[model samples]
Each structure stands twice: as structure tokens, then as C-alpha cells.
Target: MTVQINTDKNVEGHDSMNVYFTEELRTTLARFEDKITRIEVHLRDDNADKSGVEDKRCLIEARPENMQPVAVTNYADTTEKAFHGALDKIKKVLATTFEKQKP
Candidate 1:
């Protein structure tokens, strides 16, 4: 599946970060690769230019073949934490979705 990462103005994105996130997403969702078309990750600083306890936000959207897209968002004190949190949420969502298709 194709994975794309986006960041808002408050967040700075780099090649290494993109590569890292891409690898993580690929490994995490490898099972659903055939059924999933694309995965988009959006990261932002909720507090804008200020610092806060939980200003990092991560939104993950997954487009599944022949189905409406599913999305999940998470917040944490750090970008990494937010990403991991959203990742966990999306896993549950996808699992539930695919589970319903079981015979």
C-alpha cells in the first residue's frame, strides 16, 4: 500500500522522518496491504507556535479497496507518541472492519 506523510506549518518534516514513518507504516499494516489502497498520515502541532503538554497531533487515514476511507487521530506530548497512538487506533479499526468480513 502507498503511504504518505503530511505536516502542518507548525511542524517540520524531513526526508529521514518520512522514510522512518513509511517503514513503520508498511510493517505495521503489511497484513492489509492487499486490501488497502493508501494510507495518509497527517501530523500537526495543536498548540501552534507554543509548547504544551500535549500539543502533538497525528491523524491517520486509510483507504481500503471497495470501501469508504477510515481515519483515526491521536494526541500526545511528542510527535512520536502521537504517531504511535494513532497507529494503535487505526490497527483496531482495521481489525474490526476486516473481522466483520469473515465467513
Candidate 2:
């Protein structure tokens, strides 16, 4: 599956960050790779330049073949945490969706 990651201007979109997120997402969604055509991840710092609880936000959208896209968002103190949280949510959603479609 193709994975695309976008970050707000306030967040640095470096190679290392991209690689890290890509690897994490790929590993997390490996089981549904066949059913997913692409995954889009958006990262943002809601309290940019300031400190706050759950300031990091991650929004993930998964496009499954022959199905409507599914999206999930999560917030945490760190970007990684938010990403993982969102991933977990999407995984569950996709699992439930696929299960319901089974004959």
C-alpha cells in the first residue's frame, strides 16, 4: 500500500521523520495491505510554540479497495503517540468493516 505523510508547516517534515512514520505505519497496517490502496497521514501541532496537554494531533485516512475511505484522529503529548493512537483506531475500524462484508 502507498503511504503518504503530511505535516503542518510548524512541524518539521524531515527525511528521518518521514522514514520513521512510514515504517511505523507500514508495520502497523501490514495485515490490511492487500485491501488498502493507500494511506494518508496528517500530523499537526495544535499548540505550536506552546506547551499543552494533547497538543499533537494525527489524522489518518485509509483508502480500501472497493470501499469508502475510513479516517481516524487522535491526540497525544507527542507525535509518535498520536500517530500510534490513530493507527490503532483505524485498524479496528477497518477490521470491523471487513468483517461485516464477509459472506
Task: For candidate 2, give the lDDT of residue 64.
Answer: 97
Screening candidate 2 with a backbone cut-off below 3 angstroms (N, C-alpha, C), the clashing residue pairs are none
Kindly list the per-residue Cα lDDT of model 2 for residues 1-103, writing each as its tens digit: 9999999987788999899889988888898889999999999999999999999999999999998999999999999899999989999998899899899
Consecutive 10-residue window with the lowest summed lDDT within model 1: 46-55
Name the candidate that leads on lDDT: 1
Candidate 2 deviation (Cα RMSD)? 0.9
Task: Report model 2's TM-score to 2 decimal places.
Answer: 0.95
Error (Å) of candidate 2 at residue 101 is 1.2
Q: Candidate 1, residues 1-103: lDDT per residue as tens digits?
A: 8899999998889999999999999999899999999999999998998889989999999999999999999999999999999999999999999999889
Every model: Cα RMSD to truth = 0.7, 0.9
